[model samples]
Target: MTDDSGADLAWETLYGETAYMCPGFDIQREQVRLPDGTETDFDYLSESASVVVLPFTADGEVVVIEEWRQAVKRVNRGLPAGGVEGEDVDLEATAVRELEEETGYTTDSVEHLTTVEPANGISDAVFHYFVARDCEPAGEQSLDFNESIRVETTTLDALREGIRDGDVRDGRTAMGVLYYDAFA
Candidate 1:
């Protein structure tokens, strides 16, 4: 069947079930019929949208963070980011909240940069990127219990260097920085 965009390769979902449930996401398995009439089970991770904030301080320095990432078993240097909680009013609000929560930085000029599905093949994770300018230290970091974050300041050039030298391994951070630099 042709999709809204006139694509002939759209697969029709026959049925869906939760293969596993977790705190932030769920493993969803669905029986789908391909365009050519073949049926198979497709699995993917489903989660709420998230936000990434590339905040710049009043001094024009970028607000960065160093956090211990359990999945990779190392400290990751990246921008302030988090999943959109129930209390978040919107994407920009989530971005602002996450920046302040992870780095104690607050900004009045928060703008949406872009949105991307970082891992489309395996997960349905939508990340909204925002650029927060004139960020100031409003209070001490109020990180989540599972978060171990250390706040710092840096320049965009230094961040670009980190991205080039393979020091910045977080895809969301890299995408935000590169997207802002290239477009905004």
Candidate 2:
């Protein structure tokens, strides 16, 4: 047996430090020695692992959220997602918690679909996508102070149409829906 999985091409990180810090993420800069015998510095966003849940109601509708995204200067339509918090036990728990907290929807079953590095070149953002089934309204949405969210329910086909029509522009949601559609 042989292990030739590009391990030899890996760069050696000589030093790494936080260039900037914020509430959700931080900018990390690192000095590394490349496999080509060259040294350089690189910077990237360091974010916590997160989960994106595509929740489905028992009646076959999908749970979605419309939230104000300050960076994009618009209310973006997306699925329930959030960073893994300190108290979250694991990725599946975080997905369930985020689905309920962001959209007031509770699910009896959750299946992990896939994990992806959404922006590997610029950041180490690991997104765990899950399919949550039999979701029903639990209570009022419990959102963060900085969040302004509105919940909606629609058929899975309609959500897929939204993805095709460019109405669902959030990358995480789009990716989750498309991935589930193609493989799940």
Candidate 3:
């Protein structure tokens, strides 16, 4: 007996771009040959990157940020998160910067938690998670031009409840907390 089953089709990305701002979206053009030997063109949206931080105090309280999301038009409770900036900025650095900028807390130790990809359908963004331990109140928050955030501290149980009740709807935050509960 002989088996001749393999992927012989090809998918070629013709063009792609970031199409919209605000809630940024990307568009892509592609050409592909189907398994049935039919050729076709397709379009897709590219993904972006995000970061999440699980900030903890010496007493074990978790630090979270409450911010108004312009796109969602609602206040969301979650960990400090932001997009990656320059090539020199690593994911851990992004987490630290965002945590400080959003919550006004600084930590000398940051440990990698886990990464999550919320939407693979349209975006290729990764949510980098970090555990910021031994956090200290540094100063007032320094938000970006579009950000309005408030910092809050909660017990792990309260955090879990918020997540279970959908009060903490941010996917990355939920994942980070869950990861902490499981491993950290």
lDDT (Cα, 0-100) at 157 in candidate 3: 91
**Please, what are the lDDT tens digits per residue for candidate 3 over residues 1-184?**
4446544444445444444444444665556556676677666665457778899999999998888888788999888887776563677778788788888999988988877777766556777888999998899898888888889899889989999998889777788898889997
- Residue 121 in candidate 1, Cα distance off native in Å: 1.3
Q: Comparing candidate 2 with candidate 3, which one achieves the higher TM-score?
A: 2
* lDDT per residue as tens, model 2, 1-184: 5559977789899999999999889999999999898999999999998999999999988998999999989999889999987787778888989998999999879999999999999999999999999999989889998889999998878878888998889999889988998999
The regions of model 2 sitting more than 4 angstroms off are 1-3
Candidate 1 lDDT tens digits, 1-184: 4367845878899999999998889999999999899999999999988999999988899999999988999999998889987777778878888889899889999998899999999999999999999999999999788888989999999999999999998898899999888998
Task: State, as a TM-score between 0 and 1, how close model 2 is to the true structure.
Answer: 0.95
Clashes of each: 0, 0, 3
lDDT of 1 at 77: 96
Off by over 4 Å in 3: 1-10, 21-25, 29-48
- Which residue runs of candidate 1 sit more than 4 Å off their true CA positions? 1-4
Q: What are the lDDT scores of the predictions, listed in order?
A: 0.91, 0.91, 0.79
* Per-residue lDDT of 87 in model 3: 69
